[model samples]
Target: MNLNKYPVTELSGNGKLVYGCDYNPEQWSREVWQEDVQLMKQAGVNLVAINIFGWAELESSPGNYSFERLDEILDLLHEHGIGVNLGTGTSSTPAWLTTLHPEILPQSADGVRAWPGGRQAWCSSSPVYREHALRLVEQVSRRYGAHPAVRLWHVSNELGCHNALCYCDVSASAFRGWLRNRYETLDALNAAWGTTFWSQRYSGWDQVLPPRTTISAYNPTQVLDFHRFSSDELLGYYSAEAEILRQHSTVPVTTNFMITAHIRTQDYWSWAPHMDVIANDHYLDHRLEAPTIELAFAADATRGLAQGSPWLLMEHSTSAVNWQPRNIAKAPGEMIRNSLAHLARGADGLCFFQWRASVQGSEKFHSAMLPHAGTDSRVWKEVVELGGILERLTEVGGSTVTAEAALVFSWEAWWAYDRESHPSSDIAYLDQVHAAYKALWEAGITVDIVAPGADLSAYKLAVVPGLYLVRDSDAAALADYVAGGGHALVTFFSGIVDENEKVRTGGYPGAYRELLGIRTEEFLPLAPGDTPPLDNGTAASLWSEALRLEGAEAMVSFTGGHLAGTAAVTRNRHGAGTAWYLGTALEPAALRETLTQAAAGAGITVASTPEGLETVVRSNGDRSYVFLINHSHEEHKHAIQGQELVVGEEVADVVVVPAGAVRVVRTSTPAHPTNGLPTGSKDVESD
Candidate 1:
């Protein structure tokens, strides 16, 4: 299927997976390059990304280019039979460029310039910055375009990692021009942004600025639009370089996206199509209660961005990352489990942050493939072992992940819902979304995290949690989807506003009131730590709504608190399907059981799984790869009859997975008549 979509097979693997990390030879001397290549060959590394932050090294002064060291490094890697994922080395502005044009540097929302000590210092919308960066990109592309070692071209290290939004005068001028293109007249602009609230109506285009430090909270719509403008500005800068790269090179080009718990700058749904192949950089956040769950969510979201096609895991850590407040070292076998977990979700290429550990830099203490402890350490052993495992499982490459459900996720809603005023400050945008995902995850169900406006027809069940904003057309499309035989489970604090952050105005949860067949007058938010019991023998917390049923029937009612005896959860029978509504946050087990029960007519089965085992399947029409990641200490056995690719054994009826290790089985794919996706019961794993 992807052959028609993508003509290149190097990134997706012909017979071997891409196994390596960001190899920054510029950080080390020429004496270490040979040793690094030897170690890479021993570890089964085939691809290494180089020159990611080599802006200063490649071009020391303005318009002066030097590439003797890069030429030598590329030639050496080619001699060692390793392919290169080349970078344009334009992620950070060079020191001379910054000194020449200090105005090209980015500024914070409160008007403090981000200086040259860090990377991504240039303003995204600066024409001066773009002219210089594009010139460098053109030079790099022309020089290495036909080089034998080049496989893929990396546009930038991470496009919007630090500076997505800038508040400088140049950026302000760009923002006004962008608004002019969006709204032809000032009257339309004022109406859309609701600038009439604080005498902020713009009589002239230059009067409108970014939602910077204001007296109080600025207009919510203006803030929302500024976020939209900033995301577009970043995308435009990327497109400029991509156009230049395409002119000289035919390699598939992409930039690593930060799809972790934090770093929510660019709305990736809008930027997904512009990329040749979707690649992500994910690091585990140590602060969350369930960090592994967040990791899985991030991986699944990346797969969704690729539209179920196999994607690349660009950057992860070998052990502890240096950036976290308390950098916890991964356990003895934990690294392999994490890497395989991403592969199970649909990552074709597995790479880490760096090939070798740095001795002097900001990330000097960060872990790497070759750590400070050298090759005799546990981290290095696991790295080699994982590389071998990846080599053995090349059959899993280019396989699409199977999904039967959709979890609605929106960055626009994440921007608008987290604004100053809400019914409760305790309720966050991702709290309920993650809770819903965790419920499905514990039940061993797979879901595609889609946008608010994505098509729900391909899925049987759709889950929407805290989708606070919805345009009328998208809302109507969702209602039509449910009416035409799609099951939906929507939650509270959803459909409260339009695109302009304006209230939908009829009732609370304004957009979906009629579709849900429920009428809610107001919100009944409890204080922190108040877990109220429900009539169905479960408790809820954080938020509740006082509702009256129009056509829906109450499934669960509140037993206590001010909104006593009101409906806490409801089920409405629409035209051909059902709609489930939740008004309060339920416990994980309670939510799982509810979702499992609500999935009756949704064409997918929700089955129970083992306590600490995770299962995922990827298929390429002829064969299927089942990845069993055991996170617990005990070995687990599964009734699978296939060749265990990891251990290189043909098992009859059972496959044994060791503690904290991963096993992938290559088996015959199940036959499906309509969509060819795996669907049935627990044994087939559509569960």
Candidate 2:
């Protein structure tokens, strides 16, 4: 039987809880430090992310370093019995370096040189920047690598922040290198980029430059190349620091990834294999649908990276987050509910953004373990209660579970879409992907968020929507998956470009033309609310492409705006399996039907649950735990089965705890197996 090292575990259906919070003693006095630890212990907080923004304090000058304060803080935390995810403190460059070598500073896309006021403001392509940053990380890793309390190595904090697309001399040089590696000859490069039409063909390697205003010409090909180059450049920074940490540390290495921002830079699929446990900082606007469903996608993305290994919920808000438009306090039980949501989604550890309230600066108003109102506040009580629950469920502490189906998501595709310069600028790639994910969630199917090249044998089907970029071997892999009896579902704007961000010339959906069995000859951009009548007599808009089936059968056809009776959806059968293609961005109703039909062809089963009930199942060996979270404001009844594990009585019209309340129901008999994960499923409840 296949076994997992850390399987999902549940304490009688109340999910497993891992407690930790971001601890920044640098912002607080020593007197306050003592109180923070005491409160953390009371909350059952066990993991601490320390020294996230300490490079300025650690290395004050060239060849001079100070660790007296950090040493004391580490010792104090160790004495308090908390595990540490140690930060290398190289995220923010020292002011001295930026002052001496101004080239180390990043330039914006509009070619404006960035002022080094915020963290992660250094240029990725700057040699001086990389050299010093590497030195600092090496020094920090060497000194703290042996700490007994250190559980994981946290690389430079959230490496991708705002204004990530830098276009400087260093970036220009790197872009040329990237192009040379991707396309060996100028002729090949020109042909792939279709530069002959615009007189953009390069005569020599020296003529190549980063896609900037001066030499870029601002064409679709140029913008796409620039996006690819910037992504690789940022990845290089991550690679350098990861290598440094690996040299001195045996623990897994990770950098904090944030939710809903900087979607282009940090490609976790590329970096996940290097991480011991992927950690994320989740702070969403409360007005948005409770982020529990989004959190499940994040967890699956993390698990997919480590092949079903659980990750850490590194930084969540204990109370309120300061970054939102309106910094609203998490309502009664919302904090605890959100934490449980993370666990329900497969988090092995739960940590907040701050342990204590920041006394000053940008995050001063942000909530923490101890709110500004002090220890006796409601927030503090909730934190303590949450900790007590975690303390009680120590048995399922380091568990993980497996996913049977996954949706393929890629950052390269995201970046490429941003640079595509399509006829419609309003077509949002992230929103499209989330729409697909939301449909799958609404259908009660357990969907694992995956990156390109993730193993498809374990999953019966894989769905990739809005895949604008296809690199080397990616097409081959998808073809292989289909040829091997695994079904694939892909949507609009796919197979248009190669790894070089150049359009594939033979036909539209170029590389995947044969696999998809369709040739997109005409680009038909439909305006919003404009109806493109389909063969089924149904109309749709939001961008439509007139496509003809080459060896495939049309499922839906456009019938308006000069493309009537043109194929909008088609399917190709290949080696006992099928490839479904969506040519137009359908509305939610049609998209769900299309997704459901595609899934049925693959034999993927949807859970028997009510609509809007966010469901996720993580299995180990013979047991599986399904989390049914009713995220909507109104109460609803959810019909759930698959070996009930929760201890409480099963109610038919189960009152799925409203907006902030959660229920933990057992779904299976816990039978520990040899060589399997410690717990099959644990700590599953809605926040």
- Models 1 onward score TM values of 0.96, 0.86
lDDT of 1 at 38: 97
Cα lDDT for residue 555, candidate 1: 91
The sequence of per-residue lDDT tens digits that candidate 2 reaches over residues 550-666 is: 889989877666776778889999777799998887767688778777777787544344455554544444444545465567555444333333223554434344554555444
lDDT (Cα, tens digit) per residue for candidate 1, span 1-687: 121154223753344777879999988888899899999999888888998988889899887899999999999999888888899998988889999999999998899988887889999989999998999999999999999898888888888888898999999999999888998899999999887786787888878888889768778888888889999999998888889888988877888999887877789999999888788998888988788888999999999988887788988998899888899999998888899999989888889988999999899999999999999999999999998898788777778777788899988998888888778889888887889988888777778889887899988889999999998887887889899989999999999999888898878778889878998988989888888999878899888887889899999888887778889899998889888899888878889888877765576755555767787878787777777888878887777677889989996777787878788887775523212223331332222
Misplaced by over 4 Å in model 1 are: 1-4, 7-9, 12-14, 671-687
RMSD of 1: 2.3
Root-mean-square deviation of every model = 2.3, 5.1
Quality of model 2 by C-alpha lDDT? 0.70
Q: Compared to the true structure, candidate 2 yields what TM-score?
A: 0.86
Residue 214 error, candidate 2, Å: 4.7
